[model samples]
Target: MTSADLHTALLRPAVLQILRAAGFGHARPVVIDTATDLAARYFLLLASSTAQNAFNTHNTFVPTIQDVRLALTQAGALVPQMSTAEEGLRDAVEIEGVMVPFEDLRGVQGFVTWAQGPVNKEIRRIAGFGDDANVEEIAAGLDEQEDYLTALKKKHSKTGEESRYQGTILGKDTELQTVSIIGGPAASIAEWTQQSLSTAQTATLPDADEPATPATSGISSAPLTPIESE
Candidate 1:
């Protein structure tokens, strides 16, 4: 089997688990494959966008939480933003003797709502995250402040990732050396573009005392000269 097929096969079980947690008792193999592929692509897009944002804004490929948030926002993953001006206009404008209130127009953000729901809690529990229920207080509902995934990861691998995933595709025995593209000076395309633009600007800059020439050559003194007799 191809590498991609093997990767998809590995992801199918996780996707099936999520679906089962979400109340799907049985799903066709095709449906599971489609879901796994979609999930993989979505995550890949998020990672790429987050890395690009980090590199462009901070000059580093390492992404922070804020970079991931921005990437999610750009990808429309964090939806149902505050009502737009157009929606507010609906409050003032009337159609068929009915005016829709801005509050009525507003909808709950699906991502946020899903994250805070029971399904997410169940998923977390299935993934070995600590239960949100407080054993001390039986009456208390699920606590939103718990760091379950972190706790689970720490429990599994207290030392580090290198030890946990040693000799696997997810980890390496030796650190990778930095490599650049052939005939390329910078490590990344973004850095290369910035370097090229800076060099071009420096080369084309006029003397500090001299006024910079206009970019357009079509507009000349001849155009402004008044006709003598014609």
Candidate 2:
């Protein structure tokens, strides 16, 4: 397709207003033109990516709505919340298993809404990220855990320990373990608080296994040993 097709894909007025709102002055023809070109390329790239995703999923060029949604999520296109946030996207995009009209997809607002809410959940689930978690943070955490295990292993090897259990970090019952899951010291503190509490409680309680003997009368009646001569 020619550059005109890309240019036509942009809503020039919307772009100009967006720029003005962002404190930019004078949405000149040159700037608008450049912006339009980039925006068109972005949409085209999204479409291309979505199409490829569809093909990969079904081994066919024809893409389902689910495929397109997954592609948009992978590209981070579904995270931005639009002000309009209109709802009718699901109905518009999927009319009894047929794809939304290409003309409809050109409307950015509706397209954005199409990939949100329930749709975004599917995207996250398909991409293996939960709604409450970020993929980057999860990966970084995994990397940190791996590094911790590696360092601990090296320390063990240097000291000639074969089993990791010999050097495993201990845990606490009432609080998080002192074992480092972060970028600080990795030494673990032996737990004594819980044991101490248990001991204290037991010491205070009356023994159920044995009963106390009744108090004897105040009379001294006991066997006596003979005194030896000096």
Candidate 3:
């Protein structure tokens, strides 16, 4: 979704209460939108991984609650780790009368409620009440074309002296010639593929005890023999 959609979803009254708790109540419009984007991105990863994890464990396409739990636990490990999201979803909810992970995807131990609480509650809370917060007053629409990207831009354009690459990265005396917020050089990297593929395809692997023999037009040099009838 666009930043505006995420901002609106996140600013819902229920989510607002949570965000308020997390220091978003009086936060600036940009800051709040940014946090919402981060959260939305994180949960997207969580949902995908969780669903995939469930199906993977069962060796079936249909995801079970146990899969949900296992996936949540595993995906949650990447909150600030291997995950792309800044904060990952929580893993392994404590059952009322069971020792943490109950393994079986049956009964009330289902992760439906566990997965369906807090954030979900707050999200649905806005819909249930029909009193979603008016984020228009919070700030201008985050969905404006190219607005957010421009906001994040910090140009230091000047044809002048420069510093070492490491020094520039560390914000030393000289300014950066350029820096990409999104990613690194793609065209250059794509060009780096090895040309040795031809050699590998054409080169003949000789028997350890025999001298090398090159093939002509990929045909074997073994002599043709007459077919023998059984």
The number of the candidate with the highest lDDT is: 1
Q: Rate the local accuracy (lDDT) of all candidates.
A: 0.69, 0.57, 0.48
Worst lDDT 10-window in candidate 1: 100-109
Candidate 2's residue-wise lDDT over 203-224, tens digit each?
9998788897677665645656
Root-mean-square deviation per candidate: 15.2, 22.1, 19.0
Minimal lDDT window, size 10, model 2: 164-173
lDDT tens digits, residue span 1-230, model 1:
78887777667767876887788998787888889999989888999999999998899999997687778767877655443455576546566899745542223446646665665887756554456554334226355443444344456887886688677564567665555667768877778888999999999987899887767666654468667996
TM-score of 2: 0.30
Off by over 4 Å in 2: 1-6, 9-11, 20-25, 79-230
lDDT of 2 at 118: 57
Rank order by TM-score, top first?
1, 3, 2
lDDT value for candidate 1?
0.69
State in Å the error of residue 109, model 3.
10
TM-score of each: 0.45, 0.30, 0.31
* Candidate 1: residue 4 Cα off by (Å): 3.1
